[model samples]
Target: MELGYIVSGLFVGFVVGLTGVGGGSLMTPILIFGFGLSPLRAVGTDLLFAALTKIGGVWSHWHHHTIQWHIVGFLALGSIPSTLITLQILKTFQYHDQQLTYVINLILGIALILTALALSLKGWLINTIKANNSSKVVLIIRHLRSNQDFIMISTIVTGWVLGFIVTMSSIGAGALGSVALLYLYPNLYMNQLAATDIAHAVPLTIIAGLGHWHLGSVDTHILFNLLLGSLPGVFLGSRLSISIPDRAIQITLSTLLMLIGIKFIL
Candidate 1:
């Protein structure tokens, strides 16, 4: 069982390192279906795992100046509070002995389907947004921010919603969030978009992870073991991504997510 988790982490880590995608997407499912961990526990442990692993990626992006601090600030504005509220809700539900397993399964199923859609339509999504460029909306967002009005409030609210969803499912902050941001901030670069999303994700995951720890949903030992294997695997896999085609990787991962989604739904 232990070795199985380590191997799973190794594979997931490598893929994340290579493509910078599919860490929580793959790991949470493996923990639940492959190793038979509860969904609550799986998500809880994976949240912390993601936060820790992504630190390295964020640092790299920051060093490269790919992360747009303004966007990250906007995202964090909402995400921080949303995560806290979601954790509180989790706490309340657990206290009532609610069906954690069933709830987790439902959320996981939805997240997987969305992930599949995001992966499969990534190119179409990017092109569609670009084709329908909205300079007006860009100007509106910029002006609202510039004017120091309620846009900050709105951005935080948006972040809060996404943070709750991501904490529950480990699904967003990937292709889906990227797509939304592209539309909202048409002037943002792809690299900048990616970096900002990572920056937002780190804090959300940490709060969620801490909540899970309080709920006894995290397995510290397992988390450490998984990290031990994943860190190196991620490093090695990132090195290999250059040799692999991006489209092929996205397609394969999308197909995998689809299968998992359908399985859980049934």
Candidate 2:
């Protein structure tokens, strides 16, 4: 049992539970920079870690009747297959290939920066959308409401983009997904939006994580350690989420991610 890894998991899981950001945004970088794991190993281990950690959230959200299954199905339609395809492509590349690792790190860095920006801008974006009910964006939303086909097609396309990014970096299924859903389902209750995102992420992460496992990138030992600490941490954090002032947390997290992102890019 690696004590440091367990502690790291506890911190990351607690943050995820409180903020609803994907664990990968924190855990993957922690593994790489904090623990000195290779980029591929960090991403692979974080994928499975995220998958298992989110299962409990699914049940809790389901019990509260918060999930939007139709949306989740639409997301899965594109995400699942894209994850598999991305995994297969990674398998063909030698794991130790410097170029492959560099590419993964590059993608991971960009994803982190985007996730931070998304987090920082989320409240403003949502408020802007809500405030401008008569704006052109509102016109687009109204059109989407009337056009189910276009909405479905757009949802699938978003899933495809998320799947590809998550497969490579174990990020995006939460922060980026939430931003997308906020635009796609403008009227969705914020709590329901969060629950739906969590529900969709479970299967996507599990499938993508298992694919990484098959390719020998996953570290079972590290995964176990993370789970051991994270399960309890998540429960505790979630219980406290309602009382915590989240804007401060989001800003702090976003700043940290930006620094990490810049470091990775360099």
Candidate 3:
């Protein structure tokens, strides 16, 4: 077991726990640039790493009664099928082709930028919605609150977009999904919203990881090393979240992600 890989996992898991963002937004890039792994292997290994780490979150959140099963179901309705289709398309691309690597890196870079922006601007966006009672999306959500069918359809559509982005880059299921859900169900407790998003991410990532494994993209050794460190790291970070002010950490993370995004794109 590489101690360095374990350390990488530990740091990423801790950050994810502290911020409630997906590890893929950090982990995949670390593997590629920090650990000198290929982009494909980094993405594949991080997917499984993310799924395993979140299982612990789900279990804890379940005990706390934070997960909203109906919302999770609605998101899964769109995500699972979209994930399958994305994997099939990914498989059609030639393995290890220079063009393929470029495309993956480009997508990964773009996804990272998007996630960073989402994280950095989320509070502002939410506040804007609260301030502008006439905002179109906010008004639509309010109107649809009583219309279960419309709400369900909207949630599924959100999930579909999440599924496609996540399978392609493993970046959106946390930051993007939570923000979208916050818009849809603004009345839910923040803890419940985070828990529901984490719960839904588990299956989405696991299936996506399995699809990558099927295509022989996964590195079991890397996955195992990361899991070894992440499990305990997540536990420790969750404990610390109660005391730490996350805004500072989030700002630091956003800066790092922006730099990384630019690096990958360049």
TM-score, per-candidate, Cα-based: 0.88, 0.94, 0.91
lDDT of 1 by residue, 1-266 (tens): 67877888899999898878888888999888888888888889999998899898789899999987887788887777788888888877874434866777787888888878977887875665555456775455455545444645656666877787787876676666776676566578888989888887887788888888998989898898899889999989989999999999888988998899788777
Q: Clashes in model 1: which pairs?
A: 78-156
Across 173-266, the per-residue lDDT of candidate 2 in tens digits comes to 9999999999888889998998999999999999989988888889999999998888877877888889979888888999999988888889
Tens-digit lDDT string for candidate 3 (1-266): 39999998889878876777748999999898898887777788888888988887799899999999999999999999999999998899847568778987898888889888988998887786566578787776567767878788999999999898888787888988988888788778899999999999999999999999998888999899998888777778778988988788788888888888888899
Query: Which is the better candidate, 1 or 2, if ranked by TM-score?
Result: 2
- Could you tell me the TM-score of candidate 3? 0.91
TM-score of 2: 0.94
- Worst 10-residue lDDT window, candidate 2: 137-146
- What's the lDDT for residue 212 in model 2? 87
Determine the C-alpha RMSD for candidate 1 after optimal superposition of all C-alphas.
3.2
- The TM-score, computed over Cα atoms with residue i paired to residue i, of candidate 1 is 0.88
Question: Model 3, residue 214: displacement in angstroms?
Answer: 0.9
Global lDDT of each candidate: 0.80, 0.89, 0.86
For model 3, the run of ten residues with the poorest summed lDDT: 124-133
